[model samples]
Target: MTATTPPAVSMLAPARPRRPRAARVLLAAACAAVFLWPVVMVAVGAFRTSLPGTPGGWTVTKLVDTYLSPVTYQVLAQTVFFAVSVTVVSTLLALFFAWVVARTDTPLRRLVTPMMGLVLAMPPLFFAISWGMLGNQRVGLLNTVYQWLTGAGHGFFNVESWFGLILVSSLKAASFSYFLLLGPFLTMDRSLEEASLTAGAGRARTFFRVQLPLLTPAISGAAFLTMLAFLEAFDIPEIIGIPAGIRVLPTQIYSHINATYGGQYAEASSLAMCLMLIILALVAVRARLLGGREFTTVSGKSYRLERWKLGRARWLGTGGILGYGLLALVLPLAQLYLGSLQSLFGRYDGFSLDNYAAVLDDAEITGAIRDTALLAVLGGLVTVVVCTGLAAVLRTRGGLAERLVTISVWMPMALPGIVLGLGIMWSFLSVPGLNQLYATIWILLVGLFIGAVPVGMRAAEGALAQIPRDLEEAARIGGASRVRAFAGVVVPLIVPSLLSGWLLVAIMISGNLAIPVLLASPTSQTVSVEVLKLYQSGEISQAAAVFCVISTAMAAVGVVVGVVRAVLSRRTLLRGTG
Candidate 1:
């Protein structure tokens, strides 16, 4: 009877940590205070006729009146129209291409995959600028090419309108949705389809009846994200939409704050509130759709590798993939490279290195690039560390505090960048001594940091969830302290995830446009803002050169990182066996 004693439980486990828990609570509260304080001040100021101590009367009634005005409604409608169009168009395009590459044995998939990644690395504004350079009404480079080729007239390149804006936005954003859906396509269980086929169903019928049903989550998620992306778009629409008399919520807010309207902070705040509400509603719907139950199509069991015979259709599908890759990646990048080499617009008299020389020679341009690189490197490292810390704490704490922190990190992701930047500006500028940072490069970094945190946290959280808790328990039982256990065991285990998180944050920070535009000064201009400015001034050649340099450099860096990651992963796998 005395032979079988149950496993001893440690009654003297770590005390319910009062100091650590209280400090975490206080830190979270303080961070929240810093983040939301600006929006609160703007909200209050938005209602008042002027600053509280100014001569005019102060009242919340003004906010109501401003929102109800006819002009606001018109702008709101235009914003919604553009966003919806972009979302629908982009989602469809992404779905078609994803199916082509994932379901069928499409040709050049390896090449197409890397190209999509490259395009994703470029900011949205870059596409608008590239298109503008080649398609603007009077001096578009593509129109010039057409004239040279087919003797076509000048009226063909009319990207200065709403149609052009929508097309460019949708095309540029489609890459991300394509990437999102690829995951589902790769992991989907083939047996489900085989079962339908074995039951005498046709291939197309089985696809529609079985495969598509399992992919609903991925489809829904991509559409939701695309909608958010289109809704919050600023740089592309601002650059192209203005010429077509099209105004979205972001540009309207910009006009309210920066245009000759004498700085209507109150009205702008009200508009921002409206934008926040719309985004929140979308986020809520998306969360509800993606919430319950895992959608794991792949399970560890017997299976069959099913492939459809494309025959003649195979080449056509392959051609489509190649065409998209060329249009979306090759052509644009080629234009950028060629434009960078020529010193002046359409002056192919001779090639000169002056454009690149000028970009490098200017102290301001050099400084901005340096600042951008520094921010990307530092911000990426910091964001990954924070994300890993939060993910670790959440695994251990699993309470109200964990839930609150998780939600707080995602809050910034839901708010548009312009909205968040405006809130930060309003909140910090109103403070006594903090306004000095408003006009500096630091502001740009802070805004990017806010944007970076949410995505980084999500990536790290996904990786952490894959790890088993037994690893940590085993370490603790071996006499390791909590911090030591995490550092020695958890950190090494999640290195691949940490590196991935770092890469994502870096790419995002490198291409960020909205936050940098609002935060950077004339002297502290980033490459993205510079490209927009050059495009606006009809300096197509210069803009193209700048873009080429940046993109090429980034692509090279990405290759290095990818190789390192592959090596590290292999090493880890080998060591685990040993």
Candidate 2:
């Protein structure tokens, strides 16, 4: 008898080959191309003397000229200066707080820990307005307080400088690093510290040698993420730096797109392209540096974490958290209230609720807030859905889908907001019959979805992979189809993760400045864009109030979502075990 495979076995293999690999590849590519359409357009426009009318007939001379500009060189120098300052300050601050919470026996670690995460969710515009309310030379509330305290004159505190920009960005951005470092510090094996102690190493020495080395991957990742944030910052630099005559690449790009002289689309496109290239280089360097490090901070091994007794320093840690929180959170909101109560800002004679009334009265104010909320919720939901699909494709074995999704995550992240906006304008707005989206709020929504999908998808994909395959198999054995098994068994398991992704996208969309700045029509402005308008027009108090409302609303939503999620999770676990 011939040793050939059975006809039934061969038939089974071809009938339903896993996921139709080609379809998966095609979906991944189509998704990637949708995201990349803007990026490709930007590259072409950046090199052309004028915006490209045809995709095939673009020129590279604009990019060449952009490199030759002395202003471009200066912008590069300023960008590096601000980025380095923010990185150093944020990393050190994050490291200090992380150590206090994770290693020391502090009185309020639980409260402080989640608060740090909350701070991380605050939009940069809020940070800028808060600082502006307290530090701006002409209208600073804190300057008034300082004069009262020290008998000093007003206009002494200038927030529109390079130092001010760096400090503000760092203070706000540090919370991300703190969140990143907290888990690693909590999960690290305490035995390493004990071994170092046995070798006669002191607490400080053990930290430098044993603990820091193990936390290297986490630190590197946190720093790189913060660096990217500092690099791409827009609203803070726009509001504060413009007044101070300090400009970074993002603000510079904004100027080219929206400032007085009919838009300098070519120069803006060039700057955006340069920013993307710089981001790519930084990410590449980080990946290379972290390649050799072991990233297994949380393994299956369980070890009791030893907490250091911080008897006296406990108060110090508590005080530090309180002070940072007040600086970033409390003080800003207070200043906003004081500012918004004034009928005419900078006038001490009259105190009234006219500013708040005025805010309610303005048609633009109401419209912007409504638009911002609707777009944020819609964009967040779409991001969660699309990202889940992308993540699923990525979790499977090596193939075109996996490779494309991985590349998509890293690539668009490098694309600057201004450049992405410009690309969208070209591909969707400039094209014949496509400019209709530009008229509707949907254009901004599309930009928000594209901007945040990669982030949401990555988070969802990671969460989805942790679900045990046995659950799905058991469902399948009960006569369920693959789709049914996923729907019945997998969806419920990953809902919490899905919600987290949605919350992130919502926060991002609410805080987003670039796309809305470029895409929002007068009728479709967002709160961030309104705040920017007020900032640009030098209406400090009104801007501060708007900033406070938007930021505070986001933080409140985050708290509500977190609480509901916790309650739901407990009920779910109880039901599963029952």
Candidate 3:
């Protein structure tokens, strides 16, 4: 009789909900629209007869006319050459320094790490301005010092030349590659190199035959990323190349946008399309090189990093590193600090606090400081949240949907900031209701959000990959909903990574000039834009003063982040020990 009744159903049984495919699809589409709409608008504008504000229809006149021009070809060629030169030099320099620091017992190796961090902390625009001040032929501090030491009538170094441009750009580019390569160099399996050495290979042979071959993936990846970075970079070429009468694609696009008589927005869009195509081609090649290969260097095993003892040559390595720091960090910072105190840029005409006082007192500068703070904080927060969600979906849901989301999020990394700015300008101005935001700080925030999402997403994805899904699943099994499980188990674990991504985006937005330059109204001006304007107007002392303020603020933020990181790391260590 009891068996015939069929046991009472248990109301506490766990329920497994199906994945929300439609919602994920909708999210993917929404993200794609947010990220890709601007670029699509630029493409549409490029073929149009006039700018967004003007009355015109679609036409290929601008594209055909631009392609037919000889200057366009020249500029394109120069841009490729410049990018390639910087990539090669920077990658090689980074490889050398990374090797010295990670593999060898180089003196001051620990110091070199923090020095590189400082170098990265300094903005590229700041580098451009500082070097411009230091290497000016007439009144540059470096030139003056060189003249003083060598008794030369004319200055030996001119930052306005192509050589100077390449040097500064390579220095900046090297920092990026250095950071990228350092991780690989540090965690690489020493067993492979040891095997090579045990098999009768000398040190050089081991490096070339075994070590370098194993690192081909990292090296090539770094090189390609550096190339992409150089192609998108506008600060170096804009500040140094303009004065030297040297034109590249990015600078050419900028010139078209800022022409005396109302400028050519359509033409700028056309040029941006060309630049975008070139970048797409590079990306295709990079993809082909990276695909269908196993570049894994680590496994589920413990390993020790064998550091080479370079007793005598340690000093030589130390000297080379310090020399690089002198050029890349010490010299520029020293010049910037000294320039800030001077009444004039090059002349140390009896140092005074006047420039700092003037810069601090200016309403525009003060406003810029406040606006940049808001942009950094708000933009960074929005980007981190959005990118974290996108990354989580992409990581957990691997399929066509995930791939689409990944591509959409990363698309902005390929576009130059100025190009992105131009696209946003067109997108907002062409839209009926969105046009109201064209000159507002909101546009800048949105543009920066788009620009920074890739970085934040990548960081988040890496952090998420390290965490196990079992933790969330266990919570789900213990009668918790999916969202509750994720919130309770995942977010707390990834807080450090989230903080890192936020800090990175904040730093990037604070220093970014290209996005703000075109999008900002007078009321929305940022420190980067103001610094550029001041430098362009020949107010070198005032610009230097502003740069000092910005740099100091950035350094303070960096210090705070460093301290927090250290504290968190100690806590993590204690937890591990306990």
Candidate 4:
């Protein structure tokens, strides 16, 4: 009998065979084509004289026309000013809240942590519509209260103005910045603060001289990130800025592409080029200078965090924290819920379920709800899988190849939502084979996956990084193939982070408006798109009704996910002990 060789088992990673090998190759190509190609196409579209779908040679005429226009400079100035204002105010607020939560013995501080997360997840459209109705000059809730209480003839606030725009966007920026800074604050060693205190510094003095300085890098990075976010902000800008006659770059892009007739796709592409120039510069500073460089005071050794005594001041700090929670989340949600019940906004006619009935009974709206739910759950899973695969592939390589992979994974960071949507739309329309996917739900799915890669990968990398490389190597040494080792060893270890990341992606996808606004067909309409249409068409109460349903569902899903994670964790512990 012929001697039979052992079946394949320990194939090296780069030469892995059959299904796993094909998957790795397909994923890598998809990562490149999805993230990198669209931006390149945007650049191509900028110079191409033809509109998005037609054939034409490249030229600089559109680019020059865009730059030469006075409106271009005006929009640029306003965008910079708006972004800077939000960044500064939000960063300061985030810093204060982060400190309050991490170092001080403030009452109910632990609760503030989750409050910020919920605020961060709540859609920008939620804030925009809720605040819009609340701050309406004529027949708004706030105005009605003001008139009743203060005997004022007219309400002072108009949400269609710059002040309203800044307030809504700043609240969101602060919540997100606080979330990013919180992790660093919680993990930071307190040795420097202790040393400063022992060296005759008062608590206030130590906080400024030591703690603040130690946190400078993290704070600066958060500030920059916040600026980048406000730059790309679409839902708030479109809902508020457009009505105010304010033109941020994103709104400009939207207006151009959705203009009269066939629209100025080329002009919009040129505008996108301008926005991308700024974002790409910021992304370089963030990814290259700060990426992977730990700015923490110390790491790898556990240190007890000594909480600062608040004396009689705990109540003040706690109240402040709770007040922000109320403002950031509770107020908007309450106003939204109230609006949904109101027969008409600003009137105290007996509450009715009329608006909810109208929203829920609409065929289009029901379809949108189903689409949003599917995209959030299924699109979120697909994105997590793609990102996790990319992370796994990169972990096996080093130097230039890994750097290229890193850059590709984060490519979405350099493109604003409107711009990316434009690119993806134009890309699908331009490419022959891809044209088949255009105007379909699948296109929006692609956008969500690519849009979510940066976030999903960060969570995956953090979880994966915590595991020792030797553990995977041990599995390999025991004759497991790379695929088996990764599946059996790595995935089980990172389940919690994977699930957390998956939830984040889902929340983002459900709330995301810009990408879907550009990409969705009537059949593929998402809740966000429908919400915008409802709000725009003066169905104010109906819009609120739609949003309230989505918000409640998201909260329920989040709670279920938290319970599952907790149960899985407990079972793992129990099994290990047994």
Q: Candidate 3 on 1-578: residue-level lDDT in tens? A: 36575554443446668578898788779878888988998888888776676677887877888988999999988899999999999999899899998999998888877888878878899999889988899889888988889999988889999999999999888888999899999988888778788999998998888777778889998999888888878998999988998888888888998897778877888889999999999889888977898866664565778899988988999898988999999899888899999887777769999999999899999999999999999999998888777776776668777777888888999999989988888888888888988788999999988988888888788878878998887898798987798878788777777888889889988999888888999888899999999999999889989988877787788789878877776775676479
Residue-by-residue lDDT tens digits, candidate 4, 101-195: 88899889888778887778778987888888888888777777888999989997888888888888888889889987887788778877777
How many clashes in candidate 3? Answer: 0
- List candidate 4 stretches off by more than 4 Å: 1-29, 188-191, 197-202, 284-296, 299-304, 312-315
TM-score of every model versus the real structure: 0.91, 0.90, 0.93, 0.91
Worst 10 residues of 1 by lDDT: 10-19
Pairs clashing in candidate 2?
A: none
Displacement of residue 59 (Cα, Å) in model 1 is: 2.7
* Whole-model lDDT values for every prediction: 0.77, 0.78, 0.86, 0.84
In the order shown, the candidates' Cα RMSDs to the true structure are: 3.0, 3.6, 3.4, 4.8
Q: Provide the global lDDT of candidate 1 against the true structure.
A: 0.77
- What's the TM for model 3? 0.93
**Cα lDDT of model 1 by residue, 217-240, tens digit:** 888888888888777788888888
Higher-TM-score candidate of 1 and 3: 3
Which 10 consecutive residues of model 4 have the lowest summed lDDT? 10-19
Q: Which ten residues in a row have the lowest lDDT in candidate 2?
A: 8-17
Of the pair 2 and 3, which is ahead by TM-score? 3
